[model samples]
Target: MVTDPRPGQILALVGWSGSGKTTLLERVIPLLTARGLIVSTLKHAHHAVDPDQPGKDSYRHRIAGATETMLATRERFVLFREHRSADEPDLALLLSRMAPADLYLAEGFKSAPVAKLEIHRPSLGKPPLWPDWPGIIAVVTDAALPACPLPTLDLADPGAVAGFIATRLGLR
Candidate 1:
């Protein structure tokens, strides 16, 4: 279990592509929320990404050299910022922009120094990350890995994973 996480503890779901990181988060978020914990998520993309659509005012504004653009309505709002340079902001900088929540679930940023649950699928044929990464506190896998030293949980069971997270964060 985590000893003393920074305020609004951050946990990451990290794994290679097609290893079910996002899929687990999709299940875990609702479970966490239902338990009365406010949750926020941050996703990192390796490729250039734009949420705005072409021919739209927001997209046009961005294309016209606006460094930042925001589209807002009563229902929701999206803020898009352009990175002129290739350097992406680190996790700490990005977390500062988010509203306060009981927990933060990050989908990517696997290399960052944060507590993470490694999701593994044997069929993916990728080696487990915990062997080289100390930040990986536990693992969620669809297949057995007898060599892994950390606590292992079933990937198909989100409740068990959520409970583990809550327990580790000292929320339960």
Candidate 2:
């Protein structure tokens, strides 16, 4: 496969479904962009999803055994593909497709190479995934623990986290 020429940063926002990963990303994007940063996001879907309506041309193409389908407009383009029996596309593939951007934030792929920040709430009663994984760079969580080995920040403070990322990744 051809490689991407973009200089991209990868950070993953991972946590339980309700952990507010998307909400945080929604806020982070604007803050980053305001600072003149170009950002793109990649979300890993765990289920069979169809971005196009059933019986639509794109949908039919997928249902008819096409390995991949592309939908494009003057302003944007979307590629929908069926994995069939293939292994999920790895992080490299996603990164390669990223537009030339300052950063590429990923919402899932917990085991991917990208550095990650896990979202957590004490009431969720689930332990942080960091213990089982080593790629996490920091954590943005509301739950206060005795002491974490990694830096912890407020979940609501996207700017602070964005700054931290900028510093850590030398984006600043």
Candidate 3:
């Protein structure tokens, strides 16, 4: 029944702390890209994130009240946006600022208005988010989820996870 994530839309890959979300994404992204998909990612941190070292010129610029700083080189560039308050930007605004891709993959935005693929590991001893969170399209788990209503995917098969996402996004 889940639909909204067509091509060029956002789909979140989310899980509790230490639930292998990053590890699974590390494996799955390559498979999706190998099949000729351009994926962009947005990672939400629960704690403070510092992209620059204290002594770096960009850091000094930010410390001197520069809200945005661009560090560029031949191969790539990085833009750092510094916030002085606790207000976290919403997913839509963050996604809009990113360059277009076939799919926008977000990590750890539990309340965002996007479809999600949940990574669940019962061994981690934490409660699953799917039962309470909305917009979970499927679950990738290492164990049985008898009570879950969504499609259950195997955690060991990153290819299958990639395929599911591709199919859901209508790109496969």
Candidate 4:
């Protein structure tokens, strides 16, 4: 697989469904922003997604076979690119299309070749992904983890988690 690098480095958050990736991001994003760093996020959804409402013109247009649609407004606009094929764009392609920032936090694309932080919740009865996934830099968990060499951070402490992220990504 070929890899392309973007101006903003990518860090992926990986874990089981209930592992609190979103919760941690909600807390840590603010801390990262307060430190004067621009943060952008990419969410890889497993299911089919449509942001447009059912009765919206944009939705109707796409349903009628428009390959792409743009919803424009005074304050902001969104471009919807309809993919006719089954395969979704890879992480590199998505990142390239995004506006540059100090760092990019990716919530999925678990198998992608990028630095990753595994959010492990022992209570969730899920095995640690760090053992299976390549490029996992550290493990973030609330419970005590045994016999792991990677640095572990407290799940409740967003400050420490954010610090670890900045330090690893060189944004600090």
Q: After superposition, how far is residue 132 of candidate 2 from its true place, in Å?
A: 1.4
State the lDDT of candidate 1 residue by residue for 24-116, as single tens digits. Answer: 999999999999999999998999777789999999999999998999989999988887886898888788777888898999788887899
Residue 153 displacement in candidate 3 (angstroms): 0.3
List lDDT for all candidates, in order: 0.87, 0.81, 0.85, 0.88
Once superposed on the true structure, which residue ranges of model 4 sit more than 4 Å away at CA? 5-8
Ten contiguous residues minimizing lDDT sum, candidate 3? 1-10
**Superposed Cα deviation of residue 66, candidate 1 (Å):** 1.7
Worst 10 residues of 4 by lDDT: 1-10
lDDT, candidate 4, 1-172, per-residue tens: 2265553278889999989999999999999999999998989888988788888998899889998899999998888888899888888888877787888899978988889999999999888988878989999999898877899999999999999998887886
Candidate 3 residues 1-172, lDDT tens each?
A: 2133343357888898888888998998999899888988889998877878998898899999998999998999998887677799888767656786887788888898678999999999989889899989999999999998999999999989999998887885
Q: Which 10 successive residues of model 1 have the least lDDT summed?
A: 1-10
Better of 2 and 4 by lDDT: 4
Model 2 scores a C-alpha lDDT of 0.81
The parts of candidate 1 lying over 4 Å away from their true place are 1-8
